[model samples]
Target: MNPPNDPRTAADDDAALRALYGRAQAQISAGTTARLHRARHAATTGSTASPARRSWAWPAAAGFAALFALAIGMQSLAPPAPPTATPAPVLAEADGAAALDDGVADALATYEESPDFYLWLAANESTLLAME
Candidate 1:
């Protein structure tokens, strides 16, 4: 049943909102009402026409799926490349006559150049320890 006062319940509220549209027809200006009608008509017509344009989305998706399937099929049908051969690891060696020739040369050079220092260190090591 319709309430005599302002709407309180949900049904009354919904009915009150619906009645506002009829009231708006008398209150709103003629130019504003005509613009609203044109806008509503345009929106409904645009939505009905959109499905014809949106139908391309499905076919585009199907084409992409077909391309992906074709790529996978082609890859499986083709032969794989051959494995590469690796070279064997080499062993490093020196001739017996020249084995570590630089180590012996360095030791002999230092001893020959500073024989006096080596001799002094050997003779005076005990005195050095006493000083420490």
Candidate 2:
């Protein structure tokens, strides 16, 4: 006698359930494939963004060279001015003042010996005194 609830009948009606399960599995696999593709793309882009080991030295050297050149250019463009030195003292002859005094004495003697010197001096003496 056939069983009251045979598994075969349930399985015969299970086509719809099987189709649903297959669709869910397919969606999960598609999502996983898309995620894997995105992960691979991200890895590739990350590697490209990083500097290569072989070419690493060039960037560092270029940076140092640029800094060195800038330092040299600034130093050459605005060099420090030279320090100023104190000026030397001027020297005068020891007899210079004595010579000037003798010349003045001779002029006074000559002016006194002139005949009209007193009359001229008297006329201008008040003006000369006023100046004094």
Candidate 3:
């Protein structure tokens, strides 16, 4: 007969299952029990990692990391294309260099001396700056 549902809480249900499992286990043969015992032992004692796996994992990971670092460092070795155009070294602070600097002073002097020139410079200021 089937068990009653009422008055049987989880502990009662667990006792019933244990009794059923005991009866089922009592009926099994000796050879089947030994095979089951061996299978259980082998499974519980199994090593998930083998020696061959340990041999290569760290070395392979390290080699790939080194190669990646090498690729990153090689980026700076090309010397940046020599800047394509070198700016001529200015011979600043010399007598001749002072004359080259006086062009702006000379223009400013002309503007200050002539009122018409000052108006012309004010009008052309944007164009003059853009050309420079």
lDDT of all predictions: 0.81, 0.82, 0.81
lDDT by residue for model 2 (30-96), tens: 6798887877997987754345666979889999999999999999999699999977654454378
Off by over 4 Å in 1: 1-49, 93-132
Please give, for residues 80-130, the per-residue lDDT of candidate 1 as tens digits. Answer: 999999876444444543667877998889887997978888889978888
| TM-score (C-alpha, index-matched) for candidate 2 | 0.25
For each of the candidates, the C-alpha root-mean-square deviation to the true structure, in angstroms, is: 17.7, 28.3, 14.8
Maximum-lDDT candidate:
2
**What clash count does candidate 2 reach?**
0
Write down the worst ten-residue block by lDDT for model 2: 86-95
Pairs in clash, predicted candidate 3: none
Misplaced by over 4 Å in model 3 are: 4-39, 82-132
The candidate scoring highest on TM-score is 1
For each candidate, give its TM-score against the true structure. Answer: 0.39, 0.25, 0.32
- Arranged by TM-score, best first: 1, 3, 2
Cα lDDT tens digits, model 3, 42-103, are: 77989433457688889999999999999889986756765568676667647677887798
Provide the clash count, candidate 3.
Answer: 0
Compared with the true structure, model 1 gives a TM-score of: 0.39
How do all the candidates rank in terms of lDDT, highest first? 2, 3, 1
